[model samples]
Target: MFKRNIFICLFLALVISCGGDGKEMISLHPMQEKMAYADHETIMLELNEVSGLNHHMPKSLLIIHQYLNNETTSGFITNDLSVLTTDKVQISTINDSSILILEPSNNRLIQYDIEINSYEIISDQGRGPGDLYFAEELSTFNDKAFVGMQGFQLSIFDCSMDLCVYEKTINTDFNNYSIDATEDQIYVLGISPFGNPQDSDPLNSDHNLFHILNYQGDVLNSFHPAYDDRSPLVRNRLSSGGMIKTYSNKSLILIAFDFFPYLYEYEAGGDLTNIFQIDNFVQPIYESKESLHSGFSAGLIYGNKTVIDLTTRVDDEWLFLRLYERRNIGFDHVNVTFTGDEWYTYLAYNVERRELYKLGDDIKTTPGDSRVLHVLDQGIMVNNDGKLKYITR
Candidate 1:
């Protein structure tokens, strides 16, 4: 039997939405790091640049859902995986070996074997010691699976065994938005527990957005990522925090903030390696403190209102970033639509060339709901409906 309430409580414990109680807009300070590049090399993104990413992606990479059997799903939610929410589905691509999916909705972990063209449920859902409670992320190290729990717990299971058992549970006082592990330690990225009455104000708190802990959950190190300190109001909102993902094969972790159009890269052991930024991205202009506290009403007022959110995807050679730009598309408050009023911009950075290129809408419009599920060497994997789709290069 499964404890469904475990996931519900875990979800409520974590899932910190990105929003601001402050009325001011955070200032834009794109990456200002200095490094060497080839002669006449362009690193900064131009406002009118044409990325042309689709020119490279194969129109139809390979849809895996069609290969999967959905005719019978008695023990599952539905036979169709295509309808699952991509954002809620956590993916760990194993190149051509296999792909791992952690579906929190039903609390099940599925393994899609690439060569065999079949999938299996590997991890069972439960709130008990060995069971998975709100498994938001999964990564492998030395053939073992590390499951990131939303409820401030990190569980390591013996993946080499046919039936994985809980090896240990690492406890923390903070909620984990995302987690990754190396041979030596476990790393997580998330926000301070600001909503907790016991937690201090973010601006006054000493904790950083990133944390490094050993297998025993001992805090080895932490880093205070740069913040948009233009004003206290904006800084507080920026403090709501963001997510970080690791490219273990590349020994890199990509970080994206909830407030801006930039990406920060760090080496596995907590070192700032690179700062990538897109300068032309839209930034909200806050004229005064009155505008800073505007809240939802601000999105309604007349003016060129701009809002930005960042999401990132990566492969060995490239780091892909998606920016959702929303604006007030009406002449006035009359006949205005808020939820569906938005456009997307995709930017990819070549690791070898260190250049930023905009991707085409066809390729940019990935099959998934939010970020690409996985970035493989030859293609990208996305969850279309609930089916797995791979867009080949």
Candidate 2:
């Protein structure tokens, strides 16, 4: 039955790629290197100017960008103490004072008051908030925030009152690398330390794991799908890591490792209902694009190969998939952009249709020479640069 289901999925995917009525079609131009996909009425945020702030820049900075309606804004946090960095920096409604700024460079979790521009240190525990989500399931009835930790745990913050309260911890065996939450449930993804400890070997037994937990902190379900061991026709084995996204009602989507290009969809009960496998469509005749910069590669991984990061948009209709390809010794980074529209389609980097649109003019070098630009509703964010910047979109 599983083999039959897999065959059917492959056939349907091929048909969908061939212009099936149910699938959305995207085409890429040869000159255009990266392409951003969105709904027909998608709002485009063009870069205006990099904003200047009077605050002091810290050694380590993290900016969270948020966009709503016509307003775009960002919150800035840094590890430097010489300067009094606001716990929250409001891009819009600066006078309205809807932004909260947190302080204490060493605190793991900080709470902010947007209206007063005040923030309080919530918890010094855990590895800080790597990924945060406002819980819909628990929020409707109570005030709560979900924080995923790099130390393999989830921290719940009770926000029902004026001052948010830090709750206890829910422990899991897997390293909780990334997290996302909907109203009723939280989604966590992590790598198995015992399986794939070494970075060089791709064949490590570490299986990408996903967990679904309810507001009561109950383990609803756990998923660990087997990676495809078959070698790709061209590329080396692909490894999977990074954030997982869930919908308001508890629907889930996650990326998997192994060069096969796999995206899995699971139910709230933790049952795997559908799987999308991306096949590298090869052309019989092809020419290599000249590299402008060399020697630079995506820094996240060791090899010269590219690494991918996936984030879902607010609408939950489209997935923002960014590909970072490292150049040779002296070259800059090359980023190829792609989006997966349907629920069951895996994103492929070289797939012409999924490439990201180039910025300004077409300039080709290596991956390291250039950076990937992201335009949120509020401002512009650049990936290659170490710190996140927010500007008018």
Candidate 3:
């Protein structure tokens, strides 16, 4: 009887080991924290008063930045019969007239021009544009037109004429880092999620370090610390990710983690400092009964000012908040500055009038499912049926 029991136990252990190796299990660590918001709250803000007020641009200019089935592709509308696949994950606008799209699947970057009422594919460069940035302060080497691709290569394009002049391509392995450049230097934020083995382990370093690269793709300095390492919280299980911004000759790096849904601010070249936490300003409306996994949805920085929109969910309720940072005094935590209380604040462009509004609330006229394409100018583009609509305050 003992021999039979031992054989059965050994067989069970072998089966369990095999199951654990092949299957991925997501476990949420439960905490005794209370829910932030118990009931619904209404917050209203005017749209035009914010600094970067988002007005409906031309429909043709709205490009669908999509990662379908892990494949990167671009199209005008959902059913417009226009679909082009490239090296996946390259989606950015070149200028007001052209959209620089990247397909990482095919390792190609294509420029699409919008003239009159039609879309035309202009150039097909077999490379990946890592990330796209606009504004003068975020451009290193004084290149009016620029695109950063994978393999740490940045292509400076001349957009004055119809044909783009590929001035140069600099190669480096920043580890799939996202680029945000200033006149003097380019800031690349490394995104090493848990799923990617090649990326650095956050728990080991306790901070996500960003490389400050020069115009020639040379590493100048490293900035931005991981939230997990800086925070006083114990054994925190937060995933760190953020958007890089350069303004007033300073780099504004916004980092957020899931363990504690708070936004940490840091100045680019300065000692990695924590300027402000989002929770200090905007109170969380809903706290997850399980575990809250929060992350910054989108962000934009212009001049000495910065704006970030964050998304968090607790239980079945979804929460969104817009935080603003002005010239010198870090982030403004005044609740009255924006809206009082609201169920959801999708994005905030203008803060003077507290322009906080929800996206996809209008379904009757805008007939389509609301899908968040990509965040730009603190505004989100939702696919309304076959058309793209911008949701902003």
What do the candidate models score in CA lDDT, each in turn?
Answer: 0.52, 0.35, 0.35
Tens-digit lDDT track of model 1 for 161-180: 43345588887877666677
What lDDT tens digits, residue by residue, belong to model 3 across residues 151-227? 44555655456645556555655433345555666666543344256754434534434677777778777654443
Give me the overall lDDT of model 1.
0.52
- Report the Cα lDDT for candidate 2: 0.35
Ranking by TM-score: 1, 2, 3
Q: Residues 150-209, candidate 2, lDDT per residue (tens digit)?
A: 455666766666766667667666556556666677777644443245532443333435
Q: Model 2 Cα displacement at 265 (Å)?
A: 2.9
Using all chains and alpha carbons, the TM-scores for the candidates as numbered come to 0.61, 0.46, 0.46
Off by over 4 Å in 1: 1-43, 46-87, 95-97, 104-107, 114-118, 140-142, 161-166, 195-203, 225-241, 246-253, 267-274, 284-315, 327-343, 362-374, 391-393
Sliding window of 10 residues with minimal summed lDDT for model 2: 30-39
- Per-candidate Cα RMSD to the true structure, in Å, reads 12.0, 15.3, 16.9
lDDT value, residue 384 of candidate 3: 31
348: Cα error in model 1, Å: 2.4
Judge candidate 2 at residue 199 and give its lDDT: 37
User: Which regions of candidate 2 deviate over 4 angstroms?
Assistant: 1-107, 110-121, 125-143, 160-164, 190-208, 226-240, 249-252, 256-260, 273-303, 331-388
